[model samples]
Target chain A: MRFTRYLAFLNKPYLLLLGYIFLSVVLMNFSDTASLQGVRWALLQVLNVVDSFKTEFTYRKNLEAENERLKKENFYLHITNQRMREMVLENARLRELLNLKTEHSYDFIAARVIAESSEKGINSRVLNVGEQGGVRENMAVVNAEGLVGKIIGVSAHQSIVQVLTDLNCRVGARLEKSREKGIVGWGGDPWLDLEYIPKNIRVEPGELVITSGLSEIYPEGLKIGVVTDFSETDYDMFMSVRVKPAVNFNALEEVFVIKTEIPENIARE
Target chain B: MNKSHLRYLLVFLAALLVQSTIVKYMEIVHWRPDLLLIILVMYAVQYGRKLGSTAGFLVGVSSDLISGGLLGLGALSKTITGFIAGGVSRLFQERSQFIFTLFLGGLIHDLIYFYINTLGKEVAWRVIWFVHIIPNLFYTAIVGMVIYYFAGRWLKADD
Candidate 1:
């Protein structure tokens, strides 16, 4: 009987695989109610350990390269330091102009890009930040280059960011030089489209675009993208404009979730 | 039964971890292979439609939660994929490699989704049909082959 049973088991190898997949789907998907904070913290700690090791390894490798380069060209080091000082001063002055004192409030929680959307319908990416990291929904996410997106969903150690180029994303943006207001939306293509700008709003091909901050999703004055081209129709109420997004959706490594001061007057109830 | 079930649970957790963390970063022209889609096709080929549909629903929900899309969308898509894969499974000889079936299954699954997404009110038919569907089909089909080979090895020993 034991030999007969063993033979039966060998005959149906796929049944075991099916059972494995079935059980996995249930375990990973449905369990939402528990705090699971301890598990998340543990996982994050492990990830942090791994990430730190990776960073340290990279840093050491770079330092060795820098040492070799510095030995070869000792004279250029002085010029590089001076250049770095000047850039730092310029960045400080810009931050002052942006009113960094009172407006910039949220203590940013740095996150890592862990996952991205593999499906056609969903145009979202996952980050390592979540409720444990003080990430709240609608938090504006930005990289050093420019605006990235906002936090739409949160898990224990992960959150999903809908990038600016997604079809569902519609940003309230204004021309930096012209101050002409228009709504920027993605057309499922790489370029973003600016809609509802009157035919004669004085927009040009080279004008810069910035978030108007009307949507309350992103902070005002963040660089969104550059206007690449425009087209006008005689019967249309608004001109169709193409924009090149500032943030490359394909190559984003790290982004900052700006904690903008939501005005008390128009705050969501 | 209990020990084997525990092993199954571990595999699912491992799949979710990879699906959410690693697979998201893999892109070729904004096209990522639905790893869960590959998993579902594998199961559908192994199990009959009834069990396959149930597995599909579960995997879909997990995908939705992790992908952060509409909740039921994964469930709906996976269920459909499961049914189709199950039907297709009948066409092949029982001894055939699971990878062949998975390769065909993934191609059809992605095509169905691409058409469904592009046919809706949200997208221009030309844009969806040409830009989205055509590229994704080719990309996913190529990925499917890789996944099929590894899957056969992974599930064969584990099973």
Candidate 2:
């Protein structure tokens, strides 16, 4: 009987809801902005402690956010490390060019190859120097490897170089051993042809070629190329000499513009 | 406290926690099933008028306070719904009848709530009755039926 009485609390009930309903109506009279700010504050303070339990419940979510932050930081670190490596390489390249500049005491402006063209008979190069950098039409362009080209067109910020590979380009070149002058030109071939060297001249396959100073553009003694081969026929007066250019234009990057001015006497000629 | 009291307390707290935390993930057309209402009505059906009404008052006031809503709206409506559901529980035996009472409790709860909420304003009561109240009751009923199916015997244990 006592157990059934203990269970009877679940069975029978009363009109206890009316008292609460009355309290609800009273609270409604003082809702939002009237008289419960202190109660709200106290309740929120209680909730703040209660919120600690909620944080533990959502701990995995916080971990996910932390993971995302760390991943982004790692990616940023990788990009910054890559930039540091590139700067180091650029510093080494600039140092080597500095040594090349110190070896020659001429007034030369360092420039970089910005672009290259590969049209069949009209191969040319572009330099990141222009009239704004005091680059003129006939100034010689060279590098540590030797001559690159000459500035053919000058804009405000860029200059077009007619390189030695162009068929229309001609360089007055001299053999280092014999000191014989010839006009060097390309005819859609990988090697430059040095014309007007007599067949009687003693030329070897491995002779050095230098600028003849016969033109106002390129300065004298600037190394141009090496004689790779030479041949002659009984009927031909000139030896068909083949010279390989010193500058490997395919791998060219940094260069210098030798400030050779056109002489007033030869400017009209 | 006894196991029953601890059970009721944990269930109430869990209902409030789920409703506040993740119920929005299950929302349909910006309307979510009132999980708290379903649990409240289930409590009333198991316990009877006196205890049911008291539970309703405590839970409703907690919801009101926790939600930063008008201080008394949930308390008032929930108190009445608990009383009526407890009263009707004596007359109903089947699960289907309890489902109908869930619908009735939700309707009474919302009607009294909106009626009190828009007491002074010139509001469209019929529109609210059709739009918010009907859909919410339907959703609550569907969820209530499923909960009662799984946990009804446990809810009425020793009663």
Candidate 3:
């Protein structure tokens, strides 16, 4: 009788909340359960349907203006493509003469952005492509402007991309002018920080930064960002350089996944 | 179940839908408002601490599951926020002060969530507070005002 009275006195809502918390903690510890992933995939599919309807309504209203813009973009791209083809042939001949291997060829798979991280500090996005579309984990994603992110998680019809601005994201980068290699990472700000370059090397503002091909994920010579600021601390041997990313992350609508098979040797690296 | 309970359920579902679809597109300076947090706070203020905390935990869990994030972190942070918001509600009586309550609630929620999420990480507290917490607080508060206005009318009609 005393135990029953004590139970009644305690707030039921609080008890229920505690129970929920306990359950969540247990589920989180075993988060890799296939059932959990299936539920997430199902929810994403339903949400995607709603997202598509909304996008269609908005696109229909701007169809005429978008068509004109696309036409202009297509004309410019055609000219650029011809020049790129010529350069590729010349580069291939040069590589053969140097006895260098041409192993960096990649096919592109286009995907649409479905949803982005809802939390304020987290930087991630969901794409409408998945294993079915040839998107796999660790595949680098890019847009017309530049690199966007890499695939972190994938289901049957959707995948998650850890955008460049995310805290965990890091890329091997090089200064376009000086060719000094460094590790670039998000500094919990809009700008990226380039680290590990010796202070002796002169890095100036407005210098272009690009992928150094050191990272197996990103291709060499892809534009990363432009140097916006540079400084050095007396205690540290490395100069602190800030880079403003080439891609406008806030307005990302579509991206292409680079589908390249990692050779055994490169994969080991 | 009671009619009020059913009403809260609908509000929760609607908030979740809006958050995933519309709110995802409404980013400002890489920060977005927390719509579900606003709903949790409003319900907490209208009802009491116990119910508010319970709602918060549920909302956070649902969000974590849907977004594919670390699960317990959201539940832990939001549960605390709900309890605090319920206590804070006692100090205010004016309908106009609802926005202020929501803002305070949002601020508290973000701070707790940020702390919980970045515990082991080497992120500077100043950056997390300024760059993320502050913007989210103000945006959530603004959105909360709009939601409270419509919610108030809905509640009046139900009565």
lDDT of each: 0.68, 0.72, 0.80
Against the native chain B, each candidate's TM-score is: 0.75, 0.92, 0.91
iRMS values in order, in angstroms? 6.8, 30.7, 2.2
- Candidate 3 regions exceeding 4 Å error are A1-21, A262-269, B155-158
lDDT tens digits, residues A1-269, model 1?
A: 98898657434435533544454445435444344323333443444455456557867879988888888777687788899999979988998998775454456778877566656756787777787788777788998788888876666667778888776777899989878889888766677888888888888888899999777778788888999999999999899888998888788768787765545553332
Measured with C-alpha atoms, the lDDT of residue B52 in candidate 2 is 72
Q: Residue-wise lDDT of candidate 3 within A1-269, one digit each (tens)?
A: 98987777347765755766676678668666777777777878877888799889988999999999999999999999999999999999999999999866679999988887666556788899999998877888999898898887788889888888887788999999999999888776687888898999988899999999887789898888999998889999899898999999888888999997755664333
Best by lDDT: 3
**Model 2: what TM-score?**
0.46
Q: Which ten residues in a row have the lowest lDDT in candidate 1 chain A?
A: A32-41
Question: Which structure among the candidates has the greatest TM-score?
Answer: 3
Per-residue alpha-carbon lDDT of model 2 for B1-159, expressed as tens digits?
566666768888877766644554565653467877888888887777787788778888777754544667788888888888878877776646678778888888888876765566444456566656787778778888888788777665653
**Per-residue alpha-carbon lDDT of candidate 2 for residues A1-269, written as tens digits (9 for 90 to 100):** 99987766544454356578788988777765423745544444443454456556766668989899999999999999999999978877897888743233468988865444311233455566777898877788999988777876555556667788664578998999999999887633346778899988999988988989878888878887889988899998998888998887666667999876667664333
Clashes of each: 0, 0, 0
Candidate 1 wrongly placed segments (more than 4 Å): A1-107, A131-134, A155-158, A263-269, B1-13, B92-121, B153-159
Worst 10 residues of 2 chain B by lDDT: B21-30
